[model samples]
Target: MNKIISALCFSIVALSVVAQNNPSINQADTARQQRETDQVLREVGPGDSVPSLFSEEDADIGPQTVLRKKKPTWFRGTADAQIFYTDNMFFQDGNEQEAGLAVTTVEAALTTPPCITRFASYRAEVGYRHQFFNYFGSDDVLAVPGTILTRRFDAEDFDFDSSTAFAEIVAQTKHYQFRAGFDYTRLLGFEPLR
Candidate 1:
């Protein structure tokens, strides 16, 4: 009985030592695992060729071409004329006094692009207006104290002319704007002066 028990223990110890010394079993197990993984991959089929998320082809997707608008010119101007006629002039108290009036106006302006370093813009403008009145009548005399009142039949005294010139500089930013300018006006043959 002792010999049998001792032989059994010896065999168990030898088997464990052999298992540790021999690496073939480990290699076989690894090989079997690799084969199983390959078989599973083959069954799954080639995964749909996933395109790169940041590929260069995607750069051309939006707004293939840009459209540009034309810019306007810097100078502009306008001119106009008007005519008026009446058989009975108001000053003649509804009498047969033919009257005619003509008016003309002209305006012009100029603007420049903003400067690079200071971001300032410049503008200049000028305007002119003229009025001519004609009346077919005789002169009238009035009685007054310490003053001579003489009214001419022709509308020469009623005609007027005006002109204006202006220049300005402006500085602007995203939030605010600053402007400075100078203007001059002239008038001839107005009622007060006449």
Candidate 2:
């Protein structure tokens, strides 16, 4: 009985050691997996013929092909007109006055299409805007002397116009985006207090 038990233990230990150090068994398994993968690939045909999600109708399916076309350059323009009443048209803090004003704004812009490089994509845009403000129903705004806002404008002169022009460039990468822009504004009929 002792001999049988010892022999059984020795065989088990030898089998474990041989299995742990066997390279041929591992190679045989890898070769079998590769053969199965090759067979599946052959049955499925080339990867280029597979259709991906949201793919364009004319796009070619391949590793190196682009799936979408670049956006085209465009031009846009907008105009808005509004009329409203305000309790304090001149922005006086302590003293308030009631007035109605008409406002108009116009904007136009042109944007270049995206330009893609090796590291990032870039776009450029240029725009201009013109805004006008004409005040009404404020006949008594200048009736009192030494008013806080009276020094900025002449009697009964509360019309204002402003023009702005801007240009900007944006660059975007996989994880970050950068933007640089400049704008210039010119104001008319608005002045600082004396």
Q: What TM-score do all the candidates reach, one by one?
A: 0.35, 0.48
Give the whole-model CA lDDT for all candidates, comma-separated: 0.56, 0.75
lDDT of 1 by residue, 158-188 (tens): 5666766777777775357778777776776
- Candidate RMSDs in Å, in order, are 30.5, 14.8
| Top candidate, metric TM-score | 2
Off by over 4 Å in 2: 1-71, 116-121, 143-156, 172-178, 190-194
Write model 2 residue lDDT over 22-109, tens digit each, in one string: 9998898878876565444444533334223345644654434334433485887899999989887657776577888888899999
